[model samples]
Target: MEFSSWPQVPMINQKNYYTEFLKRDDQILALRLQQDERLNARKKAAVDIDRARAQAAQEGLPFLEPDPDLDEDEAMNDDDIDNYGSKTIVINVGSQNMRLGLATDALPKTVPMVIAKKAARSEAEDSEPRPKRVKLDEDAPSEEWFGEDFAREYNAMAQDFRTSRRGNKRRVLPNSRELVIKWNSTTPPERIPEHSDPLRIDWTELPANPAKAPDYIVGSAALRLPEKSKPRYQLYWPLRHGWLNEKEYDNRNMLERDFFLILEESIKNELGLTHKKDWNQYSCVFIVPDLYEKAFVTKVLDELIRDFGFQRVCFIQESLAATFGAGYGAACIIDMGAQKTSISCVEDGMVIEESRVNLKYGGYDVTETFAKMMLFDRLNYADFNLMRRHDFLLAEELKEGFTTMSDENITVQTYDFHLRASGQETRKYTFKIYDEGMLAPLGYFRPTIFDHSKKLIGRHKLIPRSVDLYNGHPNDPLSPAQLAVIAYVNQTIPSAVMPAPAKPARLMPTPMVSTPSKQRLLGLPAHLNGDKDATPLSSPAASPPAEDAGTPHPTGEDANGDEVGDLKGAQPDTEVMDRTVPIMPLEQAILTSIHHGSGADERRRREFMGSIMLIGGASKTPNLGPYLEMRLRAAVPQYPKEILVASPPRELDPAMLVWKGGSVFGKLRMTNDSWIGALEYDRLGARILNYKCLWHW
Candidate 1:
């Protein structure tokens, strides 16, 4: 104030001034941080008191509101403090498996999300046992599902490729200069701890109850029922593609029963709950998929509270939970489970609404592929039927034990596994695999292997649809490719004239066939018939003159020589429209989710670029994180030159991430008010979850 008083200001240097200014700023920030820390400590103490009051009220104990005049810590009762949220539990449910444990536990129990029911033997089928087969239409229609003749073009391409590779199948160092000798010198591949247990729930482990055997079994034990006795039991996974397997178990009531029982039984057995009413003392933190149905989520909430009797419950997106568990502020989470791989961009404890993409394929697919490949190589286990639960478990065991991903290539090797079934002697089998082991898992990179045929050589209908996934809204359930196909069909309907097969020319957008994965997910039911007996769009006529070739549109000759292509009189074949739906592959799926993240906050994409976190059951495969990173980086040049992928630390299993994060979240004092208490649920019902959840429903 005195202009440095009588003391002259030191000779000011620009560099010194700048450094001194930064020093002052740092001091101010340091003071503010210390002040905040002191305030937070008091806030935490106050939160504890509030939570205690809320808990005491919920438990029907006398409680009083805090007196602001008194110190916050002194306002809490000692007994209330101990009883507040001490029995919180966390449950992370998945399509194939789920993890459940107390918030205080270091490890959670993992169980398969499957159940087996005692199937009724029908009178007709009981006397004459036979495999159920789908009857085909006597006269199948030959409609052009693709813009061009997909089968013909695909066959021609396959013929050319086969001819080129003929007679060159038996050569050493064939694929990538990797030798069989080098491969044999290394130790045998390690087996996953689970692979051994999934296929064999020893009879001794499952003791019969004196009260008569229950009508059903759950989890891994279901997969171990003796082959001869399997006909009496029907195994069903209540969840698929990360939701209730509605289509698989068409009966809603039965499916609901199985879904509820699988989860309830697992929780009761693992958490030491001998009685159903024990859930009243416990609260649950559930993890749901990124792309969940509104109705399904609400129903689950109602069941958790009303039927399961939880004191309170809360939901968090699986991707967001993984971020919390891994201690990352932002991440691109790739959840690879048995039935689907879901990718979502998470930032600052919330999942980006526009960055959720679920692809329906995962380790189970690779297992089936491994089974087919080994069988073709003539493995010793001759009667392997993937449809059977026991055989499916065996296939999964083999896949987990033997398969791996690599950037360089694969090596030839011989592997042996012991086949142990319930109530049967263990049998030994040996098989040699070259590219098969690697090839099967590599389906994540190469989508063609997932075709209906499963041979990986050709598609069922030879359809190849070019899909651009990032061009449309992420909120829409229909993919961008599906939307585009729909638009094309609508625009061309007025003048859809088919050209001759001999000289095909499209008057529509790019020629595309329905993608296999999405075709099943987004395609219409198979009941629609394209060969409807509707009249032609115009009267029948002979072939058009040569001048029609250059015209904007050309007419088609129906079976009766009528100018028709749109078949307007015939209702749209929803099945054909499904074929035009573009396919979604792992690589494209990751890119598409990230592309939607760059709208307002460019950092949504950039922050996640460095921390692409991989979790879920199938992500445990060695080198998967790195392999995915390489493929993603190579696929997109526009991304920053350096892209990295990270997995949970070694001590933490990827499969338990959701549960772990939920545990961490449950312990946070800030989340005390977020739980849906029974009182609130009784009034609001499932709607309470909409207000209590951590993220948007």
Candidate 2:
């Protein structure tokens, strides 16, 4: 996964030629030298300001004398002052349009307003001719366009047209006009007026002018395109801190109010303002940007609730929101969004916060890098004359579209623009490139740094540091790497090193006791020793006692002809009880066995468990559940019970799990004895947890 190769560009040959030309040409070199001199002069002027300040300070005088040319009154109030107001507004600026809305209003209405800038296109330039159906003979050449060749041709033409001067033209064709006629299905197709009938033609029935054209009629028709639905009102505000200035903020607020007023008017205009209508009752929710503090989220939530009368407020982390939006349960959310590249692990409807990693490498960085690379490459190709000649309008688009990894080949269209119309027509260029081996400046970190280290030392050693085994002199010790390797080898040594078979727990043999009275009573053999095995009848026996009373008896038989008891609780007729014996309990066996094993074995087991939890992000990876289950089974081979994994709750967004959990706790039904309020928070001074004050809100 390492990007060991450098990125390649095709225009290098042309760039080399231009670089050589710049070095050989005298006029261009002179111009470059003059520009360099101007830059140096500007730098010198910048240094003079600091030097003058230092001299003035040393002399104990004012830094600068007042300019005689400047007005005294104007000079007195040169600094700008920010005027803060209670009533402030924020506008939501989008790529397509800017939206202004109210902040304090309960049901804020957003209006789409454009900062209009006029752009002119020459009337003499040609436009793309409309795709018209040419009535050809049935046997016309039917060249079916498909695959790479067709795609290349199609893209090449589109690129040329887009880069050409004529591409900017706007035109109105006579057939552009559309008509809506009040005709039934019974009305014949011929009755629908064509271009022939000028008098009977209902001009008002024609659809209003096209968005780009106002005066010319393109066509007359009965069929009319459906009117586009108007944009709906929604509230949006900027996420950046202090993005709006005072005046702009004020203006935005005013515009927001106006937008609401306009909406009310529109409702009356179209649907009529009626008592039964619910148009005025609206609600807004904001998807605020991720700020790295809980207090900021709480502040925004409080503001929305208190000022805007919002009933329910929910907060979601941006990366989690993206993961939910993309519908991936267990994924590494690599969101290369604005401002930051946020990577998070989403698993089982919960986001592991510790696993989240954010880097400053994002779309903006990529665009800037590409722009710089292009500039540098351009310097090699052309002299300073053609620098900044092209607008590079598609820089962002091209970067995004081309920087994708896939099996399919990609065709990138590029254009070299001409500053002067007469210099050169925009040259259409095509680049056939593959994403393989492309060097993406992914932030400085190896994908598997920790993994590589683990492999270098065998048996997944957590702490493989070097140390002298015998407390010998420093010169006699092994190097750290060698010692780490040795430690790992020692850790992985097989049980065969000891070469001893596992010993089962030794059981103490029960003493065989017998007496003339007890022997006859228990139907025991007369050969049993009286002192060693004889016991009182009331004494508790380990095994079930045989039923015999006080009387001497021979080993041959009982009173009913049943055989007398054999040695070790066995009947004289059976050998099964004599051969079989119960082993030690499982728990005792395990503890004894492990205690007897090497001390390193116990330590290694503990370390492995610790490392299991340390790989928090990896826990969420696919197939990890079953993998862990298998490992646990192997570790505790005696336990044969089925393991169970409790399923996480449905409807819980993993990214917002913590926030949602907190919200649930906050909203829980609490008694007066357990509730905590703002008053208590204030009284407790935020450190009430130390005192264990369980106040109820």
Candidate 3:
């Protein structure tokens, strides 16, 4: 969603604040660790008692009672405070990954925001039900998988299938029951099947309602599927381009429901909470992209407060939170995510709305580039159309590895691929990627090396001019470097000289356009309403795709199943193996932001350059720090060769930095002045956020 202008804090001695904040955080972490040890000890003691009782029952001997001092209930009650019951939790929902934790914890627990669906079992397990447990929601699907658990399982299954098959065909047993699937609709699954055997069937039509019986697996359990049963399953990326709105799903509403459920499941599992009711005791903060629509933010807030039972909930802009986490007051932030890269200038701890740039070029683009190089160039695998999720994942792994190496020439040979053609012979080949092949990911920085007919270079100007408001000609002229220093000082010192007052406010204000309630459900732009051919927001087929699925998609195929990967026969002479998309190099993005700041005050351009901070998952690319420093030195020859190109601490992952910032914000000591209590939210609704969060901008 859009970031509102935040209230500026008095410019303090930042060096002292940073040191004190770190010291307090370390103390909190140390206390948390102590609590964890106590909990573990209690658990171990309980397990020992259970074991002793079982032995006594078997041998017909008297069981020894547990020590009275070791009573768990008493021990828990005796503690000064229960950290587990604490309401302060921070959640960073990235386009590709999620990081979550209590405010006191030193680091957030992270998981890839990938969910894989598995085929539902025909029957539930026949076990004695606990009467105290809450009944399942009849309308909702009971079984689902999510996050790292799902990724692990899906990867294992894909790997097993690759290792078990010969000539892209599994050896079928004669007596095994055939499990053929009959489709209810004409549209085939996105993935074409490799085996025709019934046991390895694609999808079987079922009489069950689509909402009640989901078709796919969510967590790591999807990988445990029997080898013969693997073909029946098709992995669905609910979040394709970083949103939870997969338009490909046959039931779009069902997909959205699953997304929320998966998110809730992650929270519950991570916190070790047993019941949804327990959520009422906690206050939660969600950090999301600034590009999110108001409608999406409203929907999420409503769901979290009403359905999820959170005591209090708040939202923070990702980059702003990252600014806090990185301990920067005013710095240009380049958040390189999975499907999007956002560059924004923060002046006086506020995001420069006019300078914010979001581009659909990120880690996935790099993965796709590396994948194409491996398939079409390195291995010469002709059937590029056959590539699936696994191929790109392997490419991404290699891409990360290559980014770390200093060698000009590198070899990647472990991955093997089996290309299959229906009713034709299967060809198997292994990738032996060399230097040229490894150059694919370098496109992230050097887009000039790739085709530019699509104008991938200029889509989102990495360097944009400051809006007229930020521009101010000094009353007294000064040198460029001196001006830059003055600008830096002006930004840092709250008591700095103020600009001359503008005209008084008008008596009558312009009326604001209020969006219709119905129009707010779908997170679409308001401009769509006037377009004659604009897709209806209500159309299930036009629903947006989910955002944070980090998995790579099959590139050649279009949404309507068109084959667009014809390299030889296509009229264009240049056979660019991958799609062309604009990407602002991190170095270029920083310099442009600096230039914009320099326009406002020339002296602070160096300050901004010296405090360049990188956040987001893509920022984790090995050598990114050094590479950006080098590129910045080259881009602006006048700037000092030695400039700070900093990131979060080495122990703190860049991807989780925003979440850590949220954790800091959620702390009562930090956010007492800003938090909108649960009662306030209930009293004012989403409108309260605009006022309380200072999001009016």
Candidate 4:
């Protein structure tokens, strides 16, 4: 495979290409929305027709029955399919987002995995007088959880009433309040009332039954909650890193059912399949991480069959699907996603699972780091509690801006954080991002400077003591903490809390509350905390808090009442601490993944590493292909490795490469007899997936 022999690359400007991609994606999304509206209208019309027929029959007049072929007619109402080509709905659900639609299109419909809730309280319930400023007791479950530590000052927990059971609802609490209080630090809202924290929300009353609340809001709409209404609308991430959060969902025994409903709705509403009367009308190809256990896979398929009545369902490895999408026979894939970056070695379309490397850092970590950097150095704000979703989104914008820009020191972007205190005039703070600020996000590529290994703790240590490991369930094989640990170690924690690696890795120093210090990264200028010429301190840990308000100190002390120090004698390197984020450098992560499998043949390894396929939204950074090629070429041990990076055709989006590959795999021509039908699943069970899917030898 010579460079000249590779497929011709499409000539398109990166900016134009992505802009057009987003535009086309918006069009597809609009179609999906229309389909949902049409579905609702049809349902209402059907109900009305039934009622009219009954009334006419009672009046001793002729009654006309509704059309028997109404569903089929509505299903074919999609006139756009004729022009765009009908496609088998392909679905790829990641922790951060869900990609749905037919494979023949340029891009799949994307929806964020975030869910929001608005309690539909009756007028009577809303008029009920609220409890006045009640202080939470220390022992009243207020101090039981890490998030609960801030509960006393702000209402961390509140109840919302519902009078109906029609919409989505999940059991959150055991008491009569029946509130599903969700607190997400990942996408915190931009503003808060005088007495509230980011996670604080008031009880909402719904018109539905008092026993149930409204199901949560899903997709991008979740981000659009009014600033003032944030306290009333609870947001949750049903899927986190790659799987369901057991702590939040598993105990309810509704995890599988909820996932089924969510995916079903996504397929019908987001993919414009609302016309399909039943799941049997369409075959589904599900893409999941290779690390998923068989039991989980079977459970998923079982629900899809029993609940949704899908006629056919087949599961495939994400790496394999990505390889097929890239049109590569063998390649090492660097999937830079929202929460985790996975480096996988795929040879001839078969994934080498043992050689795969899962890093705890990804796009979200970059945004988080950049946000902290903005708060600590660029802006004068010191109260981290005031940091809102608006700030996080701005940080994300800056990161994307810098990644696309050519200049090193140029201004990336600017955003204003608006603050309005009690009885005070609204204040606006404008923050400008520079290329130096990009260093925080740049840590993902070169992580030595932002190593946060100290944050890695044994999984059992994350829980509050109040949670009983066992609640009198004698058949329980493992405690909740232990199950969480298993999920954590396997890189499946929904909240993206990565478990510690077996081997320790080195990282660069990121000190919080230390004296201003300048540090450079690979010739790039490092901006100290508002200091132009300060030198890196010999020990950032031993350095006292530079200023109380500006440079706030995180939990840096040990049980001995001394500052927590790292192996290198600096402040503990941990993501939990402010400004310090842990990430394995891209180069190291790739190389480590390449050499991980002892059984890998030299030729297979060489071919896989020789051509690297970069996919995912994070891989959209400008010049990434050339930069990686240069890095690979300059490596000391480079041999049989004229590294060539291949992205999706310029006309196609790198962010959609995986889903595209799934589209390719789902094609009837490509997989004529591979899918497991409902009958097969019923007879053979989950092992049917292993037998049907292309196995990694």
**Which model scores highest in lDDT?**
1
Q: Which candidate is the best by TM-score?
A: 1
Q: What is candidate 3's local distance difference test score? A: 0.48
- lDDT of all predictions, in order shown? 0.58, 0.27, 0.48, 0.50
lDDT tens readout by residue for model 2, 1-697? 6466777665667545644554542434333443454568557755876789889999998987546455323333413111111022222222112222232322223222211111132111112111111222223321221223323433343344234313335222222111101111112222222333332212213224334332211111101111120111112222211111121223544434332333333233323334323422322223323223322333444443444433333344443443443444443343333223333444444444323433222333334333322322221121211111122224444455444322122223233322211123322232222211111111111111001111111110111122123321111111111111112222232210122226521222222322113223212111111233432112112343354222221122221112223322322211111111111111211121122111224343232222221011111223333433443444344433532221124534322322222222222221112222233334443332222212110
Task: Superpose all Cα atoms of candidate 4 onto the true structure and report the RMSD in Å to 1 decimal.
Answer: 23.8
The C-alpha local distance difference test score for the whole of candidate 2 amounts to 0.27
lDDT of 3 at 322: 80
**RMSD each, Å:** 19.2, 37.0, 23.0, 23.8
Q: If scored against the real structure, what TM-score would every candidate get?
A: 0.63, 0.26, 0.53, 0.55
Off by over 4 Å in 4: 1-87, 118-213, 247-254, 378-392, 403-407, 410-429, 446-583, 596-603, 637-641, 669-671
Backbone N/Cα/C clashes per model: 2, 23, 34, 21
**How close to the true structure is residue 376 of candidate 1, measured as C-alpha lDDT?**
38
Candidate 3 lDDT by residue in tens digits, 1-697? 5366786667888677544553552344333443555678768877988998999999999987856655454444413233532567787765556678787777787755655555432111112121111223323221121123323433353344334433335453332111110111111223324553323322334234545544555433332223224233444444544445433455645665666765777777776776988888888887766545454566678888888888777777777888878777887777888777766667666665434545455776566545433432313442232123333333555567654312222332233444333232344444444433324445555433332222222211221211112222111111211122222222232222233226522222112111123321111111112333433222112212233222221112111111222221111111110122323444554554454334435556666777777777777776677767776676555566537788875567787788877876676332133455556567668656655553431
Which residue segments of model 2 deviate by more than 4 Å?
1-285, 288-291, 306-311, 326-330, 379-393, 406-437, 440-697
Q: Regarding lDDT, does 2 or 3 come out ahead?
A: 3
Question: For candidate 4, lDDT tens digit of each residue in 438-540?
Answer: 3454556554333233333321122211211232111111111112122222222122234445653333333432221222222111111223453321222
lDDT of 1 by residue, 379-481 (tens): 4454556666556666777888877775233445667776665555556555566655666776776444443221111111222222223321111132222
